[model samples]
Target: MPAGKGEKQPYFHCKKLNSMMKNPKPYFLLCAALIVVSFPTWSLSKTATHLDLVKLKNGTVLEGHIVSQTARSLNLENVGGMISILRESIDRVITAEPGESAMFLGAQLLERKKFARAEFFLKIAAEYPAWRTESNASLQKLNTIKEQLEEQRREKEKSDIEKLIRRKGVEAGISELERRHSAEDDYWGSVRGRLHLLMARERLDHYDLKMAEQHLTLAEKYGVTKEQWESVRNEIVAMRRKSLLYGEDKLASRAFQSRKRPDKTAAGGGLLALAGEAKKKGEKVPPLEWLELVDRYAGENDVDPLLIWALIDTESSWRSQVVSPKGAQGLMQLMPLTAKDLEVDNPFDPEENIRGGIRYLRFLLKMFKDTDTALAAYYVGPGRVERYNGIPPAGREYVQKVRTREAALNKRFGLSPQGRTLSKS
Candidate 1:
């Protein structure tokens, strides 16, 4: 017995171990062995529409247009042929549900890179996770690009930002500057204005009146938005007048208090009573914060708080990020162009949107020289108003709705005792 060969413990492994007795290939085989542990693996998926596919662990998706199927392979047609998968690669096979045949068919078209055909698919995709996320993410990326461009300009080309400020703000002979800028051109003038105003504010904040004055002059050279220019001019005038007369602007602030507020007259009445009940249960718009922003913005812009309330009600039902069917978006339901005109970076901010809308309301009133006509212009459009020379039917409807809502809001706020009347302005 040459030292019982099976009695010894196994030797350590090498790529190719060789013992004195002979080759120890069995030892190396043990070293080559790898224990693979896979975590619970499953794929999230969408059912196949003719060409729609789901990738499996093997990196191949079970694919084919189901003309007819057999026990082994599908009667698939790619570039003119039938194909087969060994079923091992398929986690499972799924087809679109019965009622969703057309929708799935559309998705199939999209997956095939049929851009035109994809449109129909996308419509269905709106409700589908795959399409919704893809579209929204794509859009969000584009918006981010725009914001980044602005940020870059803000840093590298301060002068551009300067132009934006001058075209929109005033710190000195700003009114005159604005008039000249307006007279110069009309395109992107508002942008130049905000830059000017921005520059002036920065300078003024740093106690650089000379720099501030220069910005105001540039702003006038470019054109500030009428509102911004007016505000700045008023400030400058007030400052100058105050220095000479030693008078204060006299600013005061106050808050509202919550109470058992309910409208007692109608089914919706008894806000005071409701407030009392709410106080007992702790649910109410605190009187201290009670539409204070609405009041302030309205007062400052010489707009009706009730009107803002009405706008909010119609636009979002108080929802901040609501986007409308007509593509009007955010709390105030501002159209893209309108929001841009207002220089609103974010419309979901209630205060920002409200101020912008009310400010525009003021601007429109000035343009039409009549409040009712201006409001009509707002609901329909300036173009339509100019074309029609009066309120359009749509505008009239909107105006009535807004007016009714405003009246209700006025009653709620205790601002108007007799509700509203559509008296001609």
Candidate 2:
């Protein structure tokens, strides 16, 4: 401490050396503390910026920043540069920021063509200002996809309705189409025009020239082609001339003669005259009392009214009161137990009997899904039909009789076979 300025320090520095040697434990402790504190910091610095984790289907995990995405792929940035991955191959993704996660997930789903799900995520992402622009663009794409899907669905429904028309006949098919028209807004004009055209054809087939012309006019108004209109018009004219020459005068004479007496003939004769008179007055014929009830109920149930009429004519000749040896009665020849099952109090009552019989026929038709099989079931009993896997041999004559009468009635009344026959063959 008292050494002169010119004197050099001690060469050995023995006191300092002796103090260091005695405090070697302190130096070791300080070094240990520094290492422990710095290890966690280094680890945190390496992992803290790795905010996202992507797990691939191939069992590889990637820690990176999601950069961008397209409909089919995703781009990620990491220490090893940028990498692309297919959205379909990614097993899962994890992110700390919810908004950013939604934005990225939305892009991935969009690439996968999951438009609805993508739209949901993009809407959430749109709430974040940083992702708003890209999110909105994705939403626009989703809107376009939605429109395409809706258009496809509408086209499929239209095709299905058209097929129904082919299978169910014009009136029933047009009714179904109209119901759909009321419920939908797209392609309504086209549907209406198609319905009108079908109705025109049905009317023409039935020789209702005036009604056919009215429907054709409506079809034209609704955008039917001129060629179609002209063709249908020509057909109607030809049919009308043929009907007037060969059918109408004879039908009128028969109807007038039949109506001259009610007691000698079935009530149907008078009812036919009333229908003719209503047609002359341009009025719809009211529902007839007995025989015509078959038509009304069969039409409502989508069964062929002609078939019902043929059955009634064969069973009771339109008499309302006829009993078989087996205890079958009424116009439909319903057994008492069957009438009670159908909740009919009077089997002799025409309306009740027709209703019960048609309801049973509807059930059979549904069960068989074929008119021939259903008629067979009605004739021979469903159990026998099922046992034989077809019409029983004993029931074949009955079926032939019904079919023959049905054909005769169709020819006599000028009714079309469009929706009435299950099989053309």
Worst 10 residues of 2 by lDDT: 259-268
lDDT by residue for model 1 (333-370), tens: 77776676566778877777776777767666766777
Computed on alpha carbons, the lDDT of every model, listed in order, comes to 0.52, 0.65
- The superposed Cα distance between candidate 2 and the true structure at residue 273, in angstroms, equals 7.3
Best by lDDT: 2
TM-score of 2: 0.33
Could you give candidate 2's per-residue lDDT for residues 136-195 as a string of tens digits?
A: 877898888879988999899778878987888778777877766652232132434544
